[model samples]
Target: MHPNKLRAFWAARQGLLECDTHLSPETVLEQTGWARSVGGVGPYLTLFTRAGLTRPAIDRAVAQLQIHELPSARGCTYVVPRSDFALALRCSQGFGDAAEVQTAKKHLGVTDAELDRLGRNVLDALAGGALDPAALKDRLGDLVRNLGPEGKKRGVTTTLPLVLGSLQTAGEIRRQPIGGRLDQQRYAYARWADSPLPEFTLDAAAADVELARHFFRWSGPASLAHFQAFSGLGVKASKAAVAPLGLLPVSADSPLLALPEDLDALRAFVPPETPVYRLVASVDALLLLRRDLALLLDPADVPRVQQIGGLQDLPSHAIVDRGRLVGLWEYDPEREDIAWTSFVRPDAALRAEVERTAAMIREHLGDARSFSLDSPESRKPRIAALRAG
Candidate 1:
């Protein structure tokens, strides 16, 4: 398929094109895949850019148990809808404790029996009420054993993190931001009144198969390698996962795969004649899901990507037209404006989209930090580069 047509099909399927006013953030996430959350405003951008949802509405959904961040595929966190909570937790499995516990054992000689005991204590601490890490650690006292110098060197300062993580992935506890916002990471862990796992009936293999179903729907016309990478399921499990889904090739000689239901729709789809503009977060599913940057760019725009660096990844948040990337942008706090540079020549429509996104930032989402640690000082270089362009 032509790149123009290809991008539009992806954009519409990902809910980046014309949106209906009635759609909710939970519906947006269910229709598309979950929003990737990294203690940043990407989830806010993902919902607003697609469905015109406001920050308060998304935050309300978070508070009401309509959506939440959890350890999903690859043990990375994503803001998944309530309907998917069970599936997401099922996909996360052992990966939640894969690293920290192993390192603690290697460095501080921590044992599973010890960790198991600590997990119970952590749960007991939260049973009284939700508590931030500092407060919980204080309450945990001797139960939260310090790993000392050697453990700090290995990044396992205490037993608290290891147990808290294990309990969270196991669906016994949840982390909520203290401010009731999704854009920051200062969290209070609380015991779930109703855990998501007991309601999920699938076993391990069944969970993978179900995940493959969502994966292909979320990122069809994608490669087997793409699924493998997103899943982090390794070779044998990934093959087993997709096998039952009846994934098919777009053409006999083509290397791409698609869900059985999407092929006819993709064939019938047409790119809109007029540009449909949006400014999306760097981690938005449209870019991060299938992750083929060159395919989403026009040949004319290729140089703009090179101007920053190479196709390894985007240097900043993007300005998109019907899913094709037309520009790169970042928030400039000093000016209270969106700092942007376009790959295509700026037109009235494009400029309007930029200002609209800028004002939306000021009104609802606030800063556009890609992650929690990102700050205005750290963004100076990229802001300058966009200005230079």
Candidate 2:
């Protein structure tokens, strides 16, 4: 890496960590850059918040880091973790794409004309604090079914899944099982955060502060727009939230930003070209480093790995060698095994490093056995289908 590129990489990586998604440090790791970089959400969040990150910047930063497939409509009818519902409700107000509009209508079960009305209803529910999806289900059930044919087709049914996906994007909810046969669409909800509503105000004080600091440390040679994209706080708000966290003023006045202390520490490491190993998640912090993923992957191979269907199809697990993504890994949760399938051939050193990582994963999933991909069907991650919305 050139001296300048090294500075930029450091800033970009750390900046991603600082994004405010309100996820536990562990969850954030699973969602952001350098997945499993540390142990324990407590210390990670403490260090992150202490460093400087406002809630909104943190959220936007995290958002910018993910490569998502639009969620499936039927299984995604409800959002998990209430805060996501609030954020999605807010984020969706201005979006008017044809597909977006159509999806919204299908989920809500309403007609074209009823789109605005349904939107208002979703917003109303959000404002009123109907945080639970189950509760929302009961409250909106009548409205959803009452929409006319097109209303049913366009309004409630369509909008329901869209809302769910948006909420998931905002990191406020997740999809989980409700009940029924293993293959049925019987899905319900599970809350991940204490705050069910999106705190528009967190763009300033609160957890947002911690998030910003994380980003500054991880991703310095970065722009506010990049930060905003990563955190999901929107550009202007991301800038404002990040403003108070001062910068190190590195020599070139490059767009890069760094924490004063880290600047001193970085001085010790080989500037810009240090070899560091990283395991990043699909939604990891580095995703926000560049708007287009091709910065890290070949365009031809991207769709095959990042198809948005599941972890297996995408390079959800990747190895970052000296700040560049070099290979991919995937886990079979049921078998508790890690499979390393590298795109590039590995020499002895890289192979050894990969094996060591596999060992670490096995240790992390204690009591679980490691199995080859040829392991029985029971050893594979189970694929479950849910009933229609």
Give the Cα lDDT of each candidate. 0.86, 0.42
lDDT of 1 by residue, 99-212 (tens): 778888877889999988888888888889999999988987887888899888887888888988888888999988888888888999999879979777999899999998
Residue 306, model 1: lDDT of 77
Relative to the true structure, candidate 2 reaches a TM of 0.46
**Can you write out model 2's per-residue Cα lDDT over 1-389, one digit (the tens) per residue?**
24434533453444322335454433433223332111112112222422322223333333432311112111222111222333333333333334564554455444655544544465566664434565666667755434346545444433455455445444455444332111123344333353334555442233444456655655544566566654556666676667778765555755655677756655554433433444444334454344434445544546644653432222234555554555655545454555555555566756665555445445432312222122225433421110010
Per-residue lDDT, model 1, residue 85, is: 95
Best by lDDT: 1
Q: After superposition, how far is residue 220 of candidate 1 from its true place, in Å?
A: 2.7
Which stretches in model 2 have alpha-carbon errors above 4 Å? Answer: 1-143, 146-187, 190-211, 218-220, 233-235, 248-253, 271-279, 289-316, 329-345, 356-389
| Clashing residue pairs for model 1 | none
Model 1 accuracy (lDDT, Cα): 0.86
